[model samples]
Every structure is written in structure tokens, then in C-alpha cells.
Target: MRRATSLLCFLIVMLCGTVAMAASPVNADGYYKGIKLCGRVKVVEHFADIKVKVVDSFPDLRVKVVSSFPDDVGEWQFVEYGEDFTVQFVESFPDIKIKYVNSFPGVE
Candidate 1:
């Protein structure tokens, strides 16, 4: 019985984590732009493809950028200026990743 209870607790926690990871709200004309770390300078890997989407889930959007040279890490913020989302900044380099998943109803 104790083992079963422990397993149930673990499963619950895992489910919660998954939900949180995918908590972005749905937007039909929404877009997300982010940079992903391909590899270190010594590794020399190409940047991941820039992803653009509309009427899709946030998880489906994977925007990344890579370069041969190293970039400084920083915080990235995305604010809904008009009808599109934009890459604001990054908190770190070689591992920069951001997701924009909502629209400002009346930002005009």
C-alpha cells in the first residue's frame, strides 16, 4: 500500500510539471521567436531554424538561432506591441530560449 501511494504521488507531480510546461494560452494568430543554443564555439553547430506559426500551440513553436561565435547571455522579454510577438532578450547565451503565446486584445 505504501509503495502504491508513493507511485501515485510521483505520477501526480509529473503530470503537474507537464501541465506547467505547456501552460501558454492559445492564440490563433500568435507567434513565438526564440534563440536556441546549437553548440559551443568549439563544437561549431548551425543554429536551429527560426519557427513561425499561426493557430497552433506554443509547444509546436520552436524558434532558435545559432552562430559560430559566442554570444553574451541575457534576459529576453516579449511584449505584445501590435498583432505580433517579438524576441526581447535572453538571460543566457548558447542556451537562449523564449516562447510568446498570447495576444494583447486592445494594444493599439
Candidate 2:
């Protein structure tokens, strides 16, 4: 009985960890324009195509970019605007990744 209880606890912990990791946001230093690619995205050994879009508002009829793409779908970490940034665009998905203060950044 004790062994079974311990195993159950371990499984519960692992399940929670997996959920948290999946919910984690995309890792990026900051937002930028003109690049149309995420600076933090590491070049994979195998290349997978990803599509994204920039929307006007959140919960504003735009689907999550990652969900739409099967290959490049990953967690996205939204951050506050700052200087010294470049912008990238996902062609198919239409969920805004970066939000700017002054003007909308260009995405290719």
C-alpha cells in the first residue's frame, strides 16, 4: 500500500510538471521588426515551417498562432515593448505576438 501511494504521488507530480511546461510561454529577449523571425528561436537540426499572424487585440477573434501550425507550434511569451528590437511575421496564423507602444512593427 505504501509503495502504491508513493507511486501515485510521483505520477501526480510528473503530470503537473508536464502541464506547466506546456503552458510556459515562448522564450524571447524582446520584440523587433524587419526580421520576421524570432531572435530567440534556435535553429533546429530539422527545419519545420511555422505560420503566424499579428492581430489587433487579444481574445479578439484571433486564434493562437501556435495552435494553427502543427510543425512550429510552441509556447509564446508576450512581453512589454522596449528599444533595440526586430519584428517577424507568421504567414498563416493571425495572432499578434509582439505589441508595441508607438507604432505597429512590420512582420515579414
Candidate 3:
């Protein structure tokens, strides 16, 4: 009986660890920066709920959007990655240009 209890405890710990890992997003700087290309083009269901995670290294950036809208609401926007970032909407809402301030990481 004691051995069975110990085995069960070990299984429980393993299961908890797996759950935690699955819940956490991967942090990769480059990956997050890459997603920046999506910018305004990405039609996120809840743009206000967007989360960006940036780390010192390119391999430590995470981005996610949590929204209460329906599952089929938002479509991920796609744009080309470049030094300068620009967002263009289909309508005549005016374009948003993001000037490339710097690229050396750690800049404000």
C-alpha cells in the first residue's frame, strides 16, 4: 500500500508539471519580433487583450491574445518583416507608420 501511494504521488507531480508547462507560452525574442510584422493587419478578436512577451534573447519572446469573443471572430494578420513597420487597413482610415527607432535591443 505504501509503494502504491508513493507511485501515485509521483504520477501526480508529473501531471502537474506537464500542465504548468503546457500553460506557459514559449518565450523567444525573435519569434515575438517576427509577430510584430502582423501588427495592425492581424484582425485579433480582442486587440485590447493582446499580450507581448519580450526577453533579452531572440529565443525568449512570447505573444498571445486573449479575448472573450467567439472562436471564429479574429483572423491573424500577416505582413512582411522589415526595418520599418507600416499598417494599412482596407478602408480609408489612414495608414499608421512606425518609424524604425533602433534595433540594438534594450532601447526604450
- What is the descending lDDT order? 2, 1, 3
> What overall lDDT, based on C-alpha atoms, would model 2 receive against the true structure?
0.35
Kindly give the number of clashing pairs for every candidate. Answer: 8, 13, 10
lDDT of 3 by residue, 1-108 (tens): 999999999999999987754443332222223433323233322332233322333312222222222122121224333212333322222221122212222111
Alpha-carbon shift of residue 19 in model 1 (angstroms): 0.3
Task: Go through the candidates in order and give each one's C-alpha lDDT.
Answer: 0.33, 0.35, 0.32
TM-score of each: 0.28, 0.29, 0.31
> What range of 10 consecutive residues in model 1 has the weakest lDDT sum?
36-45
What's the TM for model 3? Answer: 0.31
lDDT for residue 12 in candidate 1, whole number 0-100: 100
Candidate 1 lDDT, tens digit per residue, 7-44?
99999999998886555432222322333222231211
Candidate 3 lDDT (Cα, 0 to 1):
0.32
**What overall lDDT, based on C-alpha atoms, would model 1 receive against the true structure?**
0.33
Best model per TM-score: 3
Candidate order by decreasing TM-score: 3, 2, 1
